[model samples]
Target: MVSLSDYLILSSIIFCIGLAGIFINRTNIITLLMCVELILVAVNTNFIAFSHFLGNEAGQIFVFFILTVAAAEVAIGLAILTLLFRVRGSIDVDVTNSLKG
Candidate 1:
Protein backbone atom coordinates (compact mmCIF):
# COMPACT_ATOMS: atom_id res chain seq x y z
CA MET A 1 0.00 0.00 0.00
CA VAL A 2 1.35 3.39 -0.96
CA SER A 3 1.55 5.66 2.02
CA LEU A 4 0.49 9.29 2.05
CA SER A 5 3.87 10.32 3.36
CA ASP A 6 5.58 8.62 0.45
CA TYR A 7 3.38 10.36 -2.10
CA LEU A 8 3.87 13.75 -0.47
CA ILE A 9 7.61 13.24 -0.42
CA LEU A 10 7.66 12.32 -4.09
CA SER A 11 5.54 15.31 -5.02
CA SER A 12 7.71 17.64 -2.97
CA ILE A 13 10.82 16.34 -4.62
CA ILE A 14 9.40 16.86 -8.08
CA PHE A 15 8.28 20.36 -7.19
CA CYS A 16 11.71 21.22 -5.84
CA ILE A 17 13.37 19.96 -8.99
CA GLY A 18 11.11 22.12 -11.09
CA LEU A 19 11.81 25.13 -8.89
CA ALA A 20 15.53 24.53 -9.16
CA GLY A 21 15.29 24.46 -12.93
CA ILE A 22 13.34 27.71 -12.95
CA PHE A 23 15.92 29.43 -10.80
CA ILE A 24 18.98 28.06 -12.54
CA ASN A 25 17.76 28.98 -15.99
CA ARG A 26 17.24 32.71 -16.04
CA THR A 27 16.31 32.85 -19.71
CA ASN A 28 14.24 30.95 -22.25
CA ILE A 29 10.54 31.52 -21.69
CA ILE A 30 9.62 28.13 -23.10
CA THR A 31 11.88 26.35 -20.66
CA LEU A 32 10.49 28.48 -17.86
CA LEU A 33 6.94 27.61 -18.84
CA MET A 34 7.84 23.93 -19.00
CA CYS A 35 9.25 24.11 -15.51
CA VAL A 36 6.10 25.84 -14.31
CA GLU A 37 4.08 23.01 -15.79
CA LEU A 38 6.28 20.53 -13.97
CA ILE A 39 5.59 22.24 -10.68
CA LEU A 40 1.85 22.29 -11.37
CA VAL A 41 1.97 18.60 -12.21
CA ALA A 42 3.70 17.92 -8.94
CA VAL A 43 0.98 19.76 -7.07
CA ASN A 44 -1.71 17.80 -8.89
CA THR A 45 0.06 14.57 -8.00
CA ASN A 46 -0.14 15.48 -4.35
CA PHE A 47 -3.82 16.31 -4.63
CA ILE A 48 -4.52 12.93 -6.17
CA ALA A 49 -2.38 11.15 -3.61
CA PHE A 50 -4.14 12.78 -0.70
CA SER A 51 -7.53 12.14 -2.24
CA HIS A 52 -6.72 8.46 -2.51
CA PHE A 53 -5.20 8.17 0.94
CA LEU A 54 -8.00 10.01 2.74
CA GLY A 55 -10.78 8.48 0.60
CA ASN A 56 -12.18 11.86 -0.37
CA GLU A 57 -13.37 12.76 -3.85
CA ALA A 58 -12.87 16.49 -3.26
CA GLY A 59 -9.12 16.34 -3.74
CA GLN A 60 -9.49 14.57 -7.05
CA ILE A 61 -12.02 17.11 -8.19
CA PHE A 62 -9.67 19.88 -7.17
CA VAL A 63 -6.93 18.22 -9.14
CA PHE A 64 -9.12 18.26 -12.25
CA PHE A 65 -9.77 21.96 -11.76
CA ILE A 66 -6.07 22.59 -11.30
CA LEU A 67 -5.32 20.70 -14.50
CA THR A 68 -7.87 22.75 -16.38
CA VAL A 69 -6.40 26.02 -15.13
CA ALA A 70 -2.90 24.86 -15.88
CA ALA A 71 -3.93 24.08 -19.42
CA ALA A 72 -5.30 27.59 -19.82
CA GLU A 73 -2.23 29.13 -18.24
CA VAL A 74 0.08 27.24 -20.57
CA ALA A 75 -1.97 28.22 -23.59
CA ILE A 76 -1.99 31.92 -22.76
CA GLY A 77 1.58 32.01 -21.53
CA LEU A 78 2.82 30.36 -24.71
CA ALA A 79 0.91 32.76 -26.88
CA ILE A 80 2.44 35.71 -25.07
CA LEU A 81 5.87 34.19 -25.23
CA THR A 82 5.47 33.65 -28.96
CA LEU A 83 4.52 37.25 -29.46
CA LEU A 84 7.38 38.48 -27.32
CA PHE A 85 9.87 36.37 -29.23
CA ARG A 86 8.59 37.67 -32.51
CA VAL A 87 8.92 41.28 -31.41
CA ARG A 88 12.09 41.07 -29.33
CA GLY A 89 13.77 38.48 -31.58
CA SER A 90 14.79 36.56 -28.47
CA ILE A 91 13.14 34.56 -25.75
CA ASP A 92 15.45 35.39 -22.92
CA VAL A 93 13.62 36.12 -19.68
CA ASP A 94 16.60 38.04 -18.35
CA VAL A 95 16.08 40.57 -21.08
CA THR A 96 12.59 41.21 -19.82
CA ASN A 97 13.92 43.82 -17.46
CA SER A 98 14.20 46.10 -20.44
CA LEU A 99 10.44 46.25 -20.65
CA LYS A 100 10.35 48.63 -17.71
CA GLY A 101 8.38 51.83 -18.27
Candidate 2:
Protein backbone atom coordinates (compact mmCIF):
# COMPACT_ATOMS: atom_id res chain seq x y z
CA MET A 1 0.00 0.00 0.00
CA VAL A 2 1.42 3.33 -1.02
CA SER A 3 1.39 6.10 1.55
CA LEU A 4 0.84 9.84 1.11
CA SER A 5 4.51 10.50 1.57
CA ASP A 6 5.36 8.14 -1.28
CA TYR A 7 3.04 9.95 -3.61
CA LEU A 8 4.39 13.31 -2.51
CA ILE A 9 7.96 12.16 -3.05
CA LEU A 10 7.12 11.01 -6.56
CA SER A 11 5.45 14.31 -7.26
CA SER A 12 8.48 16.16 -6.00
CA ILE A 13 10.76 14.17 -8.26
CA ILE A 14 8.60 14.87 -11.29
CA PHE A 15 8.36 18.54 -10.40
CA CYS A 16 12.15 18.77 -10.13
CA ILE A 17 12.59 17.08 -13.49
CA GLY A 18 10.18 19.57 -15.06
CA LEU A 19 12.04 22.46 -13.50
CA ALA A 20 15.34 21.11 -14.76
CA GLY A 21 13.99 20.68 -18.26
CA ILE A 22 12.70 24.25 -18.32
CA PHE A 23 16.06 25.57 -17.18
CA ILE A 24 18.26 23.38 -19.41
CA ASN A 25 16.25 23.55 -22.64
CA ARG A 26 16.80 27.25 -23.12
CA THR A 27 16.94 27.15 -26.91
CA ASN A 28 13.64 25.72 -28.08
CA ILE A 29 10.30 27.32 -27.29
CA ILE A 30 8.40 24.10 -27.89
CA THR A 31 10.58 22.22 -25.45
CA LEU A 32 10.02 24.91 -22.85
CA LEU A 33 6.28 24.60 -23.36
CA MET A 34 6.49 20.85 -22.87
CA CYS A 35 8.40 21.37 -19.65
CA VAL A 36 5.68 23.67 -18.45
CA GLU A 37 3.13 20.97 -19.16
CA LEU A 38 5.25 18.50 -17.28
CA ILE A 39 5.25 20.80 -14.28
CA LEU A 40 1.47 20.97 -14.44
CA VAL A 41 1.25 17.21 -14.56
CA ALA A 42 3.30 17.03 -11.37
CA VAL A 43 0.90 19.41 -9.69
CA ASN A 44 -2.07 17.35 -10.82
CA THR A 45 -0.48 14.23 -9.43
CA ASN A 46 -0.25 15.88 -6.03
CA PHE A 47 -3.83 17.06 -6.21
CA ILE A 48 -5.16 13.62 -7.04
CA ALA A 49 -3.06 11.97 -4.37
CA PHE A 50 -4.21 14.37 -1.73
CA SER A 51 -7.81 14.02 -2.79
CA HIS A 52 -7.61 10.28 -2.44
CA PHE A 53 -5.88 10.41 0.95
CA LEU A 54 -8.16 13.02 2.43
CA GLY A 55 -11.39 11.55 1.05
CA ASN A 56 -12.55 14.88 -0.29
CA GLU A 57 -13.79 16.02 -3.69
CA ALA A 58 -12.40 19.54 -3.53
CA GLY A 59 -8.96 18.55 -4.66
CA GLN A 60 -10.40 16.74 -7.66
CA ILE A 61 -12.45 19.79 -8.54
CA PHE A 62 -9.36 21.95 -8.32
CA VAL A 63 -7.52 19.50 -10.52
CA PHE A 64 -10.19 19.84 -13.18
CA PHE A 65 -9.93 23.60 -13.01
CA ILE A 66 -6.17 23.39 -13.36
CA LEU A 67 -6.54 21.10 -16.34
CA THR A 68 -8.88 23.48 -18.08
CA VAL A 69 -6.64 26.44 -17.40
CA ALA A 70 -3.60 24.52 -18.51
CA ALA A 71 -5.24 23.63 -21.80
CA ALA A 72 -6.11 27.26 -22.47
CA GLU A 73 -2.62 28.32 -21.49
CA VAL A 74 -1.08 25.84 -23.89
CA ALA A 75 -3.29 27.00 -26.71
CA ILE A 76 -2.46 30.65 -26.20
CA GLY A 77 1.21 29.92 -25.77
CA LEU A 78 1.31 27.91 -29.00
CA ALA A 79 -0.49 30.67 -30.86
CA ILE A 80 1.96 33.26 -29.66
CA LEU A 81 4.85 31.00 -30.48
CA THR A 82 3.43 30.46 -33.93
CA LEU A 83 3.22 34.19 -34.51
CA LEU A 84 6.73 34.68 -33.20
CA PHE A 85 8.01 31.95 -35.50
CA ARG A 86 6.23 33.41 -38.51
CA VAL A 87 7.52 36.90 -37.81
CA ARG A 88 11.06 35.97 -36.83
CA GLY A 89 11.47 32.59 -38.56
CA SER A 90 12.90 31.09 -35.37
CA ILE A 91 11.80 30.27 -31.83
CA ASP A 92 15.11 30.77 -30.12
CA VAL A 93 14.96 32.62 -26.82
CA ASP A 94 18.23 34.41 -27.37
CA VAL A 95 16.81 36.14 -30.43
CA THR A 96 14.16 37.89 -28.36
CA ASN A 97 16.78 40.09 -26.73
CA SER A 98 15.90 42.78 -29.25
CA LEU A 99 12.26 43.70 -29.69
CA LYS A 100 12.14 44.88 -33.27
CA GLY A 101 8.91 45.84 -34.94
Candidate 3:
Protein backbone atom coordinates (compact mmCIF):
# COMPACT_ATOMS: atom_id res chain seq x y z
CA MET A 1 0.00 0.00 0.00
CA VAL A 2 1.23 3.48 -0.86
CA SER A 3 1.51 5.87 2.03
CA LEU A 4 -0.04 9.28 1.65
CA SER A 5 2.90 10.93 3.34
CA ASP A 6 5.30 9.29 0.95
CA TYR A 7 3.21 10.41 -1.98
CA LEU A 8 3.08 13.97 -0.69
CA ILE A 9 6.83 13.96 -0.10
CA LEU A 10 7.47 12.68 -3.59
CA SER A 11 5.23 15.36 -5.01
CA SER A 12 7.07 18.01 -3.06
CA ILE A 13 10.41 16.75 -4.29
CA ILE A 14 9.25 16.72 -7.88
CA PHE A 15 7.88 20.23 -7.58
CA CYS A 16 11.17 21.45 -6.13
CA ILE A 17 13.09 19.82 -8.92
CA GLY A 18 10.92 21.54 -11.48
CA LEU A 19 11.39 24.86 -9.74
CA ALA A 20 15.13 24.37 -9.76
CA GLY A 21 15.08 23.57 -13.44
CA ILE A 22 13.12 26.68 -14.19
CA PHE A 23 15.47 28.87 -12.22
CA ILE A 24 18.67 27.26 -13.45
CA ASN A 25 17.78 27.04 -17.13
CA ARG A 26 16.86 30.50 -18.32
CA THR A 27 17.78 30.11 -21.97
CA ASN A 28 15.94 27.53 -24.02
CA ILE A 29 12.16 27.73 -24.35
CA ILE A 30 12.02 23.96 -24.63
CA THR A 31 13.70 23.52 -21.24
CA LEU A 32 11.26 25.94 -19.67
CA LEU A 33 8.39 24.01 -21.20
CA MET A 34 9.78 20.78 -19.83
CA CYS A 35 10.04 22.28 -16.34
CA VAL A 36 6.46 23.47 -16.54
CA GLU A 37 5.37 19.99 -17.55
CA LEU A 38 7.23 18.51 -14.62
CA ILE A 39 5.45 20.86 -12.23
CA LEU A 40 2.10 19.91 -13.69
CA VAL A 41 2.91 16.23 -13.38
CA ALA A 42 3.76 16.74 -9.73
CA VAL A 43 0.43 18.40 -9.14
CA ASN A 44 -1.34 15.54 -10.86
CA THR A 45 0.48 13.05 -8.70
CA ASN A 46 -0.61 14.86 -5.57
CA PHE A 47 -4.20 15.08 -6.76
CA ILE A 48 -4.42 11.37 -7.50
CA ALA A 49 -2.70 10.43 -4.29
CA PHE A 50 -5.02 12.57 -2.21
CA SER A 51 -8.04 11.28 -4.04
CA HIS A 52 -7.10 7.75 -3.25
CA PHE A 53 -6.24 8.55 0.33
CA LEU A 54 -9.51 10.37 1.00
CA GLY A 55 -11.63 7.90 -0.92
CA ASN A 56 -13.08 10.73 -3.00
CA GLU A 57 -13.62 11.06 -6.72
CA ALA A 58 -13.52 14.85 -6.68
CA GLY A 59 -9.75 14.94 -6.52
CA GLN A 60 -9.46 12.71 -9.57
CA ILE A 61 -11.99 14.90 -11.36
CA PHE A 62 -9.93 17.96 -10.51
CA VAL A 63 -6.84 16.18 -11.75
CA PHE A 64 -8.60 15.63 -15.08
CA PHE A 65 -9.30 19.35 -15.32
CA ILE A 66 -5.70 20.14 -14.42
CA LEU A 67 -4.49 17.77 -17.11
CA THR A 68 -6.74 19.48 -19.65
CA VAL A 69 -5.46 22.90 -18.65
CA ALA A 70 -1.87 21.71 -18.80
CA ALA A 71 -2.39 20.38 -22.32
CA ALA A 72 -3.94 23.64 -23.43
CA GLU A 73 -1.12 25.57 -21.79
CA VAL A 74 1.51 23.51 -23.55
CA ALA A 75 -0.18 23.88 -26.95
CA ILE A 76 -0.50 27.63 -26.66
CA GLY A 77 2.98 27.96 -25.21
CA LEU A 78 4.54 25.96 -28.01
CA ALA A 79 2.72 28.04 -30.59
CA ILE A 80 4.05 31.19 -29.04
CA LEU A 81 7.53 29.71 -28.88
CA THR A 82 7.36 28.83 -32.54
CA LEU A 83 6.37 32.38 -33.35
CA LEU A 84 9.20 33.71 -31.25
CA PHE A 85 11.69 31.45 -32.97
CA ARG A 86 10.41 32.53 -36.34
CA VAL A 87 10.76 36.19 -35.47
CA ARG A 88 14.13 35.94 -33.70
CA GLY A 89 15.68 32.88 -35.40
CA SER A 90 16.54 31.40 -32.02
CA ILE A 91 14.74 29.44 -29.31
CA ASP A 92 16.49 31.21 -26.45
CA VAL A 93 14.02 33.21 -24.40
CA ASP A 94 16.72 35.55 -23.13
CA VAL A 95 17.68 36.54 -26.65
CA THR A 96 14.09 36.62 -27.85
CA ASN A 97 13.36 39.45 -25.42
CA SER A 98 15.13 41.94 -27.66
CA LEU A 99 12.93 41.07 -30.64
CA LYS A 100 10.15 43.55 -31.45
CA GLY A 101 8.21 44.25 -34.62
Candidate 4:
Protein backbone atom coordinates (compact mmCIF):
# COMPACT_ATOMS: atom_id res chain seq x y z
CA MET A 1 0.00 0.00 0.00
CA VAL A 2 1.15 3.52 -0.74
CA SER A 3 2.15 5.66 2.23
CA LEU A 4 2.47 9.37 2.85
CA SER A 5 6.21 9.18 2.43
CA ASP A 6 5.78 7.64 -0.98
CA TYR A 7 3.49 10.44 -2.05
CA LEU A 8 5.84 13.06 -0.67
CA ILE A 9 8.78 11.47 -2.42
CA LEU A 10 6.96 11.49 -5.73
CA SER A 11 5.99 15.09 -5.26
CA SER A 12 9.58 16.07 -4.49
CA ILE A 13 10.83 14.26 -7.54
CA ILE A 14 8.32 16.01 -9.77
CA PHE A 15 9.17 19.36 -8.21
CA CYS A 16 12.85 18.80 -8.80
CA ILE A 17 12.24 17.88 -12.43
CA GLY A 18 10.23 21.04 -12.90
CA LEU A 19 12.98 23.13 -11.32
CA ALA A 20 15.55 21.51 -13.54
CA GLY A 21 13.46 22.12 -16.64
CA ILE A 22 13.03 25.77 -15.82
CA PHE A 23 16.75 26.23 -15.22
CA ILE A 24 17.83 24.24 -18.23
CA ASN A 25 15.43 25.87 -20.67
CA ARG A 26 16.66 29.35 -19.93
CA THR A 27 15.97 30.70 -23.41
CA ASN A 28 12.54 29.16 -24.03
CA ILE A 29 9.56 30.94 -22.49
CA ILE A 30 7.09 28.22 -23.44
CA THR A 31 9.14 25.47 -21.81
CA LEU A 32 9.59 27.59 -18.71
CA LEU A 33 5.85 28.11 -18.51
CA MET A 34 5.33 24.36 -18.82
CA CYS A 35 7.85 23.75 -16.06
CA VAL A 36 5.96 26.17 -13.82
CA GLU A 37 2.83 24.13 -14.45
CA LEU A 38 4.72 20.99 -13.49
CA ILE A 39 5.76 22.57 -10.20
CA LEU A 40 2.17 23.58 -9.52
CA VAL A 41 1.02 20.05 -10.19
CA ALA A 42 3.61 18.77 -7.74
CA VAL A 43 2.27 21.14 -5.11
CA ASN A 44 -1.28 19.98 -5.74
CA THR A 45 -0.16 16.39 -5.39
CA ASN A 46 1.23 17.13 -1.95
CA PHE A 47 -1.94 18.93 -0.94
CA ILE A 48 -4.10 16.03 -2.01
CA ALA A 49 -1.89 13.47 -0.29
CA PHE A 50 -1.89 15.33 2.99
CA SER A 51 -5.59 15.99 2.82
CA HIS A 52 -6.30 12.33 2.36
CA PHE A 53 -3.96 11.30 5.16
CA LEU A 54 -5.27 13.88 7.67
CA GLY A 55 -8.96 13.29 6.92
CA ASN A 56 -9.51 16.99 6.35
CA GLU A 57 -10.96 18.81 3.32
CA ALA A 58 -8.97 22.01 3.81
CA GLY A 59 -6.05 20.88 1.70
CA GLN A 60 -8.33 19.94 -1.16
CA ILE A 61 -10.06 23.29 -0.90
CA PHE A 62 -6.70 25.03 -1.04
CA VAL A 63 -5.79 22.93 -4.04
CA PHE A 64 -8.92 24.10 -5.79
CA PHE A 65 -7.95 27.70 -5.25
CA ILE A 66 -4.47 26.96 -6.45
CA LEU A 67 -5.81 25.38 -9.61
CA THR A 68 -7.93 28.42 -10.28
CA VAL A 69 -4.98 30.74 -9.87
CA ALA A 70 -2.73 28.54 -11.95
CA ALA A 71 -5.22 28.51 -14.79
CA ALA A 72 -5.43 32.26 -14.78
CA GLU A 73 -1.66 32.56 -14.67
CA VAL A 74 -1.23 30.32 -17.69
CA ALA A 75 -3.82 32.22 -19.66
CA ILE A 76 -2.23 35.57 -18.92
CA GLY A 77 1.27 34.32 -19.49
CA LEU A 78 0.33 32.90 -22.87
CA ALA A 79 -1.38 36.10 -23.92
CA ILE A 80 1.63 38.16 -22.94
CA LEU A 81 3.97 35.77 -24.66
CA THR A 82 1.90 35.93 -27.81
CA LEU A 83 1.96 39.68 -27.84
CA LEU A 84 5.67 39.77 -27.16
CA PHE A 85 6.28 37.33 -29.95
CA ARG A 86 4.26 39.43 -32.35
CA VAL A 87 6.25 42.51 -31.47
CA ARG A 88 9.69 40.92 -31.33
CA GLY A 89 9.30 38.02 -33.79
CA SER A 90 10.82 35.71 -31.21
CA ILE A 91 10.37 34.96 -27.50
CA ASP A 92 13.99 35.07 -26.51
CA VAL A 93 14.51 35.76 -22.81
CA ASP A 94 17.60 37.87 -23.46
CA VAL A 95 15.72 40.13 -25.87
CA THR A 96 13.00 40.79 -23.31
CA ASN A 97 15.50 42.37 -20.96
CA SER A 98 15.63 45.46 -23.22
CA LEU A 99 11.95 45.37 -24.18
CA LYS A 100 10.73 48.73 -25.43
CA GLY A 101 7.34 49.54 -26.86
lDDT of each: 0.90, 0.93, 0.91, 0.94
Q: Model 2 over residues 1-101: C-alpha lDDT tens digits?
A: 99999999999998999999988886888989998988999999999999999999999999999999999999999999999999999999886779576
lDDT (0-100) at residue 36 of candidate 1? 93
Candidate 3's error at 31, in angstroms? 0.6
For model 3, residues 5-87, the per-residue Cα lDDT tens digits are 99999999999999999999977889999999999989999999999989999999999999999999999999998888787
> After superposing candidate 1, which stretches have Cα over 4 Å from the reference?
none
Which stretches of model 3 miss by more than 4 angstroms?
99-101
In candidate 4, position 2 carries an lDDT of 100
Clashing pairs in 4: none
Higher-scoring candidate on TM-score, 2 or 4: 2
- In model 2, the runs with Cα more than 4 Å from the true position are 99-101
**Model 4 agreement with the true structure over 1-101: per-residue lDDT tens digits:** 99999999999999999999988886889989999999999999999999999999999999999999999999999999999999899997776778477
Tally clashing residue pairs in candidate 4: 0
Residue 9, model 3: Cα distance from true site in angstroms: 0.9
Q: Model 1, range 1-101, lDDT digits (tens) per residue?
A: 87889999999999998999999988687888888998998999999998998899999999989999999999999899889888888889776887566
Alpha carbon lDDT at 22, candidate 4: 84
Instruction: Provide backbone clash counts, one per model.
Output: 0, 0, 0, 0
Weakest ten-residue segment in model 1 by summed lDDT = 92-101
Which candidate number maximizes lDDT? Answer: 4
Off by over 4 Å in 4: 99-101
lDDT over C-alpha atoms for residue 70 of model 4: 100
